[model samples]
Target: MPRRSYDHYCAASRALDVIGDRWSLLVVRELLSGPRRYSDLFADLPGISTDVLATRLKDLERDGILTRHRIGPRATSAYELTVDGAALRPVLDALSAWGTPALGERRPTDAVRAHWLALPLGRAIGEQIDKGTVTVRIGETVFHVVVDGAEITHQDGPAPGPAIDLVLDLATANAVANGTLALADAGPDAQWSS
Candidate 1:
């Protein structure tokens, strides 16, 4: 199907012409962590239908926001952000900041994923530390975030080498993510161990 457009000449409209679809940005969000297999994306996105996921992936690829490549010993195909897609980090950050207040309460129907906290929490951590890895444990979920200068990246498991281990409950984690509480100001709520 031909993609739709706003038919406007403005730059913002032009950008939106490529990404205004419902699931496009969310797909970009998932890929920001790194490459992911189709099954991984499907599993992480709770409510997306397989058909919709496939369509969004194709659309993103067609628009140059992402690319599909082979990786690992089995040469599994994975989707990863292109430079253009990674550029969406600030956009996501802006949205996260703007939407934080809307996240006042977690509805029972809201789907929760620990890795979803990586972006905001990583942003907060990046502000306080210049370099090093921090392994964050929230409940049973474990993920490690690497802060390098102004860039932050994360993966779904613990860091391979030595890292600062920090643990938080969901409430504290949410506060960190929403900017209500800085990671540094998390105080006693943040349990840190070398």
Candidate 2:
């Protein structure tokens, strides 16, 4: 094998090249929610035309960022993140943080983003549930936490009961977590709105 050069084989450099295009990472973002059909991906991405969606999906597949699989006995197909693809969570998180101020605020949907980072909220909440049952959703990730008298039992999936739904843009979420921005008021800069 030829020796890897910093410029040629740098992991970070190669990753940027693959995800440099705006849509590529967005596709990955959708996939983090789990397997999505081609149609669903297109639907989530409002403005991407069919041709563009097809091209981007194929491009991501080619780069091993995604894996396309046939689902159901009827052979419907869906796309999901590969092991390599899952590694992009940090990148996506970063993108979410960076893009929040510019791209997140204008959405008309009432979906609230509860942002938590100061504590292992998953664990903290797990310790607080009465008789051990509650529900929480953080982005695409969901889980059930069992409260065993101040002990935490962590499990994945939507928990049951009223969750303290905290919503914030990715940037706000990051700021709250990193202590750079307060959770009390995190929104897009007014200029981004107009």
Tell me the alpha-carbon RMSD of every candidate: 2.3, 9.8
**Best candidate, TM-score-wise?**
1
- Model 1 CA deviation exceeding 4 Å by range: 71-75, 185-189
Which one is best on lDDT?
Answer: 1
Error of 1 at 185 (Å): 4.9
lDDT scores of the candidates, listed in order: 0.88, 0.58
- TM-score of predicted structure 1: 0.87
| Tens-place lDDT digits, model 2, residues 28-90 | 766764688988788778677888788778777888899999998889889988989878865
Clashing pairs in 2: 113-166, 113-167, 113-168, 114-166, 114-167, 134-160, 135-159, 143-157
What is candidate 1's CA lDDT for residue 141? 84
What is candidate 1's lDDT per residue for 10-76, written digit by digit as tens? 9999999888898899999888877899999999899999999999999999999999999889988
TM-score on alpha carbons, each prediction: 0.87, 0.55
Q: Which 10-residue window in model 1 sums to the lowest lDDT?
A: 96-105
